[model samples]
Target: MSKPYFDPDFDNLLERINGPTCRVCIDNESMEDCTVVKVDSVNKQGLLLEVVQVLTELNLTISKSYISSDAGWFMDVFHVKDEHGNKLTDQKLINYIQQGIGTTRETPSSAKAKTYTNKVFRPERNGYTTIEMSGTDRPGLFSEISAALAYLHCNIVEAHAWSHNDRLACVAYITDQSADTPIDDPGRLADIEEHLTMVLRATTAPSTSGNQANQQEVKTAGFLQGSEDQGTMTNVERRLHQLMLSVRDFDGPSGPPNLPAVTPTGSEESDEEGRRTVVMIESCDEKGYSIVSIDCRDRPRLMFDTVCTLTDMQYVIFHASISSGGGYAFQEYFIRHLDGRALSTESEKERVIKCLEAAIERRVCEGVRVELCADNRAGLLSDITRVLRENGLTVVRADVATQGEKAVNALYVKDISGNEVDMEFVESMKREMGPIVLHVRNETNGRSSLPPRSSRFSLGDMLKSQIDRFNSLTAL
Candidate 1:
């Protein structure tokens, strides 16, 4: 086989080998009604989500938490309680958690085979190149697409993606980095499409080479074997030292950096006008990264949306803090462009804030109506409708039709409360629904589902109630 594509700088192999390991200890002597769970682990991508997922699966509710990460190591302490608000005394459960987090798993390669369609490229009114892609969804699909764009040195200004039933669609506003202009050249546009298509079609499986595996094992053992330098500093101290070195590099001006001026928006301060989501972006001189702070009401999938938006825009998060209490979430992220520079213009900063604001607004608003066509199956309609309900959506009208094995579904839906569905919600629905359609199509030998027909209806009281609550919150 051809040598696998490898970039030491990009892959950060050493970092992966030394990825976070977890240790969980229960504090029996804590003076509280809840159990105290102490976790120490090496931090990596999706660390928070993993921890939260485990706790949630265990049916543990976190009453309070203290989370911090320095360099690659993180220490999190959570005050948790069982469903009855009692301290957890189950030894087996505690042991299960301890073992669950102690081992590291290899990160999966991004290359995967996916089907793409509705490929389109056009010039936006804002003098930016717009690229829209729709295709079958899989894990790491977004990363692969972003990687393709980065390879072409494209600067993404605005992006939105949605996935439903395993189908995914994304619309990105980007500009050519080298030219700093719209990608109007037909040749360049074709080249971009070709490269993106290749990425989408590529398939990669994990290496099975014993020798390569042994080499990785040896490297890991060496780290644990210890050295004289390891004796001089504790692990936490070493991590802090590494963090300091990284900060120094970030702060040092390697080029003529154009930094945005800092202006406080007073969004963080409390006012009698109720809770208003505040988004602020300012330059951090010490770290040479832009600190984006958001103070907003907490809700389901809030962090996912915010992080997704930033990731879609090609922002590299170096450090972040997320905390929520009293029905509000406070988040601060230290970030830089993928090229390691701060945003260069006022318009750029504004765009970043605007995107974040839009994300936040969409979380609370009614979503857009969606229409889907797929192969018919038993319980297919119920499955699709269930997904909508689970995602906090209310279907106001439905038109379902079945012609032979093919089915067409048109649903008018809004946020459980009646507000315009956000782009994020639309993309999420598409990602989820795409797979079901694909599976049904295959089972029927590529035949379409029978088209069944339904009728449209007026909004119900539940939707009205949601709208009232939303209005009340916004009024405050």
Candidate 2:
């Protein structure tokens, strides 16, 4: 087993000053398909997440990556490309990446991390109030919340909504409608909180059989936050992951009601469309490391999701390799607990596997992609969502943003029964919302576009080859 080169208990200024920091080098000619980015830095918990987060936030695609951290240093190489699958040729973007990825410091230890006293809303210095909520997944939920905010004269500047395992987590950035600034009045903030809380706790419409459980109000919670947990503030997407985990969204019922939830390898058949994400964990006893292997459909921001979960779970990734092709992603990680122990128990392994799966599937939005670009106005979000609800469409995920005078929103919607959206209804929606305002971006069949499992190349073989390469590096 390898060990850290630095002493954890050391306090000498020279030793600290001479310790390793971060260095980033980008190579555009390493390969024709992608740019190669290599980072050498001091090994610290959460460092990997920070690097991945930067790349993800920059909207770059990580086609492949190699990570190794032993002897107190992080050495990683990422093969990345732009959203259009082209090499990052922009010098400005490359420079920004070097600066962004090279400056991440170790997150403070838990004892030094900030603790929150107010669990409701905290006004950010940028003149916006951030509100967070998690609750049971149901149709029209976002509409209800937005309606309440509109009633309170709050304008949602930006918002992200994600649903997984029959649960929902949302982060909305809002400002006072008239003032165009953060709502500083405690009374007004309280009213906002109360109204949202009631909306979240409202019961779902009863089914034909009138099940009392479905009729009962869901147990939900909301909190206002100025920033994410731990020491440094993170992006809103990562904050959503933290919020969902805190609410135990991973432990809830799998998928939407009447939809098959993805499970482990032995029984993941429920999600026939995407073939559920597969996560496996086993101990590399000789190296005192726990190896996590995952195979799932390739999607944007996938690396960020998995790495974020591992960091939050306090797992230190010592080595990892990621590759994607043929519409699927395969990743392998050598990790140890923050306490420097391999995952030792069956329950622990199971929990990590489940959480990792949850992380990956959380953003795997199922439904049709509809994009709206129109002039921004009051009650716009509420009206759009209400129209969806009335048309028998349910939103699985949404991204709302306001840029200057335009409202650019993306909504992934499906039939209320968790089926593909009807093109006819979508057309009607376009006419009602204005044909030029709302457009049907894409219709997803809710299945992997790739061929069947038997027809595709073997994932096990791909994983084994990657593992072999990773092992060779570690051995050297």
Candidate 3:
């Protein structure tokens, strides 16, 4: 869609800079003075402004921010002393900030590193063509390779990442936020791909050597969005980013197909036209769990594409959550509302599941795994902690898991010695804690709720407990 442009001057630094101190930093390092209050997707300058604008919008305060630019490579440094500066714990957020600017989630992923994947559209950005890059994960690889994108002003918007027990993959989406500049400049993408080749090179020994092991593939795809869809695009883009991260986080491609809720009764949607119908999945999170995994594979983009395909095929979406593999994914979509279209023919359901199954197959690793069971018992959490302590680990964040009359305690922790933990230890601890199951991990990346750093307890649970105590005192 063609978007009109306006060049607005960013003379209001005071408002953005009005936070508490002049010196702001992250991980204790001080940032140089850098404050921008506006963004222009048309001109390259506006891209910088958008970076600043997104940080500000997320309520992230960084004082004395410093930026380095050489050729087309760019590096931005800032400090965030608190969570509000970065609410959601997202790998994408970290990657976004590392490159330039991005949004923050209300829920934070408490980790030294976070990685996610997403899909985005820039209707008609000017000056800078939006560019993104992603591939297998490597240490310090991003810093060395992103210089190419920075040199060409490929402001990073989002990055998605995930690795199996042995392999890794990543994707980064960047849009030129410069006003008065085109959003699809060839120089931008070319610079990015060149640097991408450099960034993706393996300096270390190969792990997946044979046919699947010795090589790596990095491909790029792009599409311009429509103007009428801009309003929806923001939601779509943000969700896409979240979905990408969720997939990588969950390692969706490694999991099995989620059980289909609709059983085939040998009934065909009476439509002789043979149009495909969408899979209609409706169920509370899996039994014994509040959240389950979805095979996101291509991240939420796969989910989005599937949803779009269903819509085009005349299906309707009632509710959806692309974050989980919901490949173990969940959606209450069907063709019930189609214009007299018989939606759930036996073949249609089979075909829809097949389509999603294919999506999971191509994207999911044949290796990811997940397991769940009830966890509500006395001293369950304490036992979990005891086991962790015995295993030479420390609890980083533990949650109070209760269902009805039972209580189950869950924790997110890391090995203090950085030792590779045995699955048996985790399972044994769960058994001791009476969590109802031994272990649960996404089949692909082995990404589980236990490993990642989490801060979910910061939300109202404590306050609610305190309120409960006060009410009990009143009753006494």
Best by TM-score: 2
> lDDT for model 2, on a 0 to 1 scale?
0.72
Q: What shift in Å separates residue 332 of candidate 3 from its native position after superposition?
A: 4.0
Q: What is candidate 3's TM-score against the reference? A: 0.30
Name the best candidate (by lDDT): 2
CA lDDT, every model vs. true structure: 0.51, 0.72, 0.35
| Candidate 2, poorest ten consecutive residues by summed lDDT | 224-233
Using Cα atoms with residue i matched to residue i, what is each candidate's TM-score against the true structure? Answer: 0.39, 0.81, 0.30
Hey, what RMSD does candidate 3 come out at? 22.6
lDDT of 3 at 30: 27
Question: What is the lDDT, from 0 to 100, of the residue 38 in candidate 2?
Answer: 90
Of 2 and 3, which scores higher on lDDT?
A: 2
- Which portions of model 1 show Cα errors greater than 4 Å? 1-21, 26-37, 43-67, 78-100, 103-105, 109-275, 304-319, 337-344, 358-476
Q: Which stretches of candidate 2 lie over 4 Å from their true place?
A: 1-20, 106-115, 205-234, 252-260, 264-266, 269-276, 431-436, 446-476
The lowest-lDDT stretch of 10 consecutive residues in candidate 1 is: 216-225
**Alpha carbon deviation, residue 9, candidate 2 (Å):** 30
